[model samples]
Target: HGGLVAAGEMTRTYLWRILFRDQVPPETALLLDNNAEFTGTVRNSRTLWQQDFEQPAPGLCGTPALQGGCSLALDAAHPHSTEWVIPARPGQFKWVRASAKARADQMEWDMNRMTQYVIRFRRGNEIVKARTVRLQRALVDAGWPRELHFDVRPPKADFDNVSVTFLYYGTTANLLLDNARLEAFDD
Candidate 1:
């Protein structure tokens, strides 16, 4: 008779038992068979944390307006209407848009608020080569809630820091800003 030689192999078994009295069944035994109790936890662990891209209070010259108010208007002549500078890493982005509102006026104003403007980005002394973004909608359309969405792509290489700025050319009008956010999607 010939016998085979095993080099490196191991076998193990796990056994669990629960003891309950005759009056009641063990609670732990019942939990082992129930699958509904552990439904959504075992899938994914990634979460999203949103940060608002808003300027500080002192940045604007006039009184800081709230979202509840009618419109948000800053002295265009003033240097600092609202300035927001955020640090960004090199990555592909689906869209970059800012949301704002225009005040209701019966008179025929320039409707400058309705017209769109450009958004620029800079890095240090040199300006990053990119196209301008425009404001597309008025706030009163959807009950003073306006949002602008645009597609943008920053250079992947040779860029260290990013400086964002909003430029608009219009007459005096009330501009409302409820909320503004910059969203990026993973490739």
Candidate 2:
């Protein structure tokens, strides 16, 4: 199965719990905040912004991290593009992407405004295949919701490091990412 295991097949939910929580584990003290570096700019009556991941909140998943830590980044030079990266264990892992209630409105706008966000992976020297999750209209009606669960198996050749990116249209508004979890599932 490489690292692609079915989360439902797990015997205990402890691993799943730890992977999804926002709080840093005492044993792993290397939490990074990437949201602090975002440079907000307004363009053509629109703006793009980014946020960092500090600690995972309860019932949340997939905090947005940038090039350094999990956070958001926007390049004014490319007015229509914004990027979000999340770092995880270098293997086949399943992630649950979620957001907070406070950011529900903006999240809904971003989903419905422009094209859908695209998710991709980067290894040492090569970029892997890309996956996309379209925003559902129902989610917007409820409020700007968060996340589309992604189950991906990264390239085995580059187990030392891996990065996941979300490409958004320049018109996308603010979004808050939280509660990111990675799980080892049964094949």
Candidate 3:
């Protein structure tokens, strides 16, 4: 099978599911937000996750959104967002690559809050794991958006949600996020 797409269906396909092929190596999108671009309408869209961050103190945008003149903005006081992607069936999977483009309005080596781009996994309200790309002052100072990716190995297969959010530990600073993606890889 080729050019096959499945969403929120509890579906699985490989070179073969009845007889697994390690060499063929199955790669499928358990959650699909390829560019993390928020370009959908209610008429036809993926309704599982927060498609756009226009609520909870409604903001400008989400995903690779500078193109749309918007991005998911996060500050220290408002540290995290929720439900970027929800897998159709999380228990059948082991590894996921979470990615996003991040840019900070301000970052300093010792700022009360230094922005960290994160792929957060959750079983419910509890955070199962956080994979982070710690931003350096110099990188932010360079004035170019950084795209980051990391593999998440959940301690268990029960993680119910995946979020690409910007988190700040301290008390000040802002981070802009775009291009959120959560993709599954078979192991």
Task: Report clash pairs, candidate 1.
Answer: 72-175, 72-176, 101-176
Q: Candidate 3: where is the Cα deviation over 4 Å?
A: 1-65, 83-85, 88-91, 105-107, 136-141, 170-174
Winner on TM-score between 2 and 3 is: 3
| Candidate 1 lDDT by residue in tens digits, 1-187 | 0111112311110012222223322122222212111212222222112223244344342223434322234445532334445555564342333223333232212334333333334565355745443232222233233444343345555544444444445534344343444444432
lDDT, ranked from best to worst: 3, 1, 2
- The TM-scores of all predictions, comma-separated, are 0.47, 0.36, 0.52
Q: Measure candidate 1: CA RMSD.
A: 22.9
**Per-residue alpha-carbon lDDT of candidate 2 for residues 1-187, written as tens digits (9 for 90 to 100):** 2132224433232244346665523212101101111113312221112234443232222234322234332223332232444554443343222221222234333333432334445554355644444332213333334443333334444433333333335434444333333333323
* Model 2 spans > 4 angstroms off: 1-52, 55-119, 135-138, 142-147, 153-160, 172-174
On a 0 to 1 TM-score scale, where does candidate 1 land against the true structure? 0.47
Q: Give lDDT per model, in order.
A: 0.35, 0.33, 0.48
For residues 117-176, write the lDDT of model 3, one tens digit per residue.
566677776777666545533233434576655455555545777766556566243556
Better of 1 and 2 by TM-score: 1
Residue pairs whose backbone atoms clash in candidate 3: 63-178, 63-179, 64-179
- Which of candidates 1 and 3 reaches a greater TM-score? 3
State how far residue 117 of model 2 sits from its true place (Å).
Answer: 5.4
- Candidate 1, superposed: residue stretches over 4 Å from native: 1-72, 92-118, 136-143
